[model samples]
Target: MTRSWIGRRAVVAATFLLALSPLAPAAAAPPVVEAAGAALRPAGAEVVAVTKVAERLTDLSVRSPALGGRVVKVRLLTPDGWNPADRRQHWPSFWLLAGCCGDYTAWSGTDIAKIESLRKVLVVMPEAGWNGWYSNWWNHGAGGDPAWETFHTVELRRLLEKDWGASSNRVVAGLSMGGQGALLYAARHPGMFRAAAAYSASAHPLLNTESINRIMGFFGGQGGDPRRVWGDPVAQRNIWAAHDPYYLAHHLKSLPLYLSSGDGTAGPFDQPDALEADFNRQNKALAAALTQAGAKRLTTNFYGPGTHAWPYWQRELHSSLPILLTALNVRP
Candidate 1:
């Protein structure tokens, strides 16, 4: 037999043997290739599956190393003409975070998907655990697994920008627990988001005893040990202060910010007598601190009569869109 023919037969035989070998290294496989031949690098976090929920919405099941190799779902609301297969085109990103007990579907469950102004933007809603608090758990200072901050800001951010066609320009908005998350992210990661907005958020959880106590209650929810989050409020005061937006106001002074909250009383959306929400006071404290820190472009809509609810948050979303889109250089 000729040398070339013998070589071809040997290669085919090796391929067949490798396919049947039980000791094959499947975990060491190369990157995933898209329909358009774009390769998704299997680095930190990677999307393993995709589901098209609607004409505009696509769900990505990402395997995250930050979350200890746990798989998480991230929903994307793609703009008109957005195609993951097309690597040449990219769009600005809008990160909409969920509250304490909510999931990634919170924003999608609302009417945000129908907004016409967002026709050219990509919305990213990630699953930040039921009580993740947008933080890397202190875990008594070991600081491992359930590192939400690392997952969202590092792994997921790179994955989206590289494979999902998201550009560097981004804006963020959230309500309640998510509101706190938005502020923390913006203040902690300077220049990451063009603008940020918070509606009835726990902005100054370390502002006073009331705020601290209330948040401690939240940290202990879902039967989770409160100490696992940020450690003892007294022992880990530095950690608490680090995550508190009030303490990080200086970091946000240069960015465009939108802050809004109600006095907790009944308004257009609530019944005759709605109890005042503690977050109103917390948000006010945050606004004052931001202003003191020289936030020139800050917008305050402390619309006195409302309470913490979806109707008000929905209204604030529309109200803050102008600022967010303006920062994005998009027409509102």
Candidate 2:
């Protein structure tokens, strides 16, 4: 019975060891292991989750009591010796996101992990489950979940900062569908985030009514009213306007903005028919509209040979990182 066994809360019996000695001699003590950052294994670009996230930077699967049965899985990326309460002025963070039917772990597993050179800034990737839309479902019909917008914008931010030392200055960005969320959240909550970036983001939700319908069907029924989440695009034009990044072009001038997309020719979403042309034209029009609105201090990139896939998003993020740093003013 050595002191190491006591340190780890393992029950050690010398009698058991003596009994085993009859079969084989006592083995040498293994190295004393510390349970600090030692729990994580170094993956190529990402840190593998080891221990549970009760104390520090780890993946946490939390059921938001406020949002009914909807569960939020988050990967809390933190620096070494991270303390949530210690407010020593850390770098601002961005909530990197994924598309519809994507989980929280997507960004961490994707190529975006390599672009996270600004270690001070932590990225919290939260899962928006099947057709959650990151918006609150109307009528409380599907699981009676409160608006997810409130949960992410208000609750999740406060929780992470208070418990995980996540900085107050944060941006929310994503690819495809999440791109729309990042833009919408930034436009709606103008003062909340310093900058918002979206790559191949679904620019106009109202335009793609049928796709929205299909996505909504996963939660409850087909063609369910979207205003339940974002309000009537017609009657609630003001609310929908608040989310239109192109319409709110003035707000984005000073606030950092990044937009990028691939040619609508190769991706799964890009059905090579008139439907694809409509989406492409709409997105292109949005970008052009922002430019025509005299929106300044913004960067927009279009990839020629790429399609809407992980590889394209990876490249986009790599290119967008420098711009994000400049916007957030994070050096090194």
C-alpha root-mean-square deviation, each candidate: 18.6, 20.7
Clash numbers, per candidate? 0, 4
Model 1 Cα shift for residue 330 (angstroms)? 1.1
Relative to the true structure, how large is the alpha-carbon lDDT of every model? 0.76, 0.56
TM-score of each: 0.84, 0.70
TM-score of 1: 0.84
Top candidate (TM-score):
1
Compose the digit string of candidate 2's lDDT tens values, residues 144-242. 746666566666666666556677777777876677778766766666777778877767544444323322232332333334654444445455455
Off by over 4 Å in 2: 1-57, 85-89, 140-143, 207-228, 231-242, 267-279
Candidate 2, residue 321: lDDT: 76
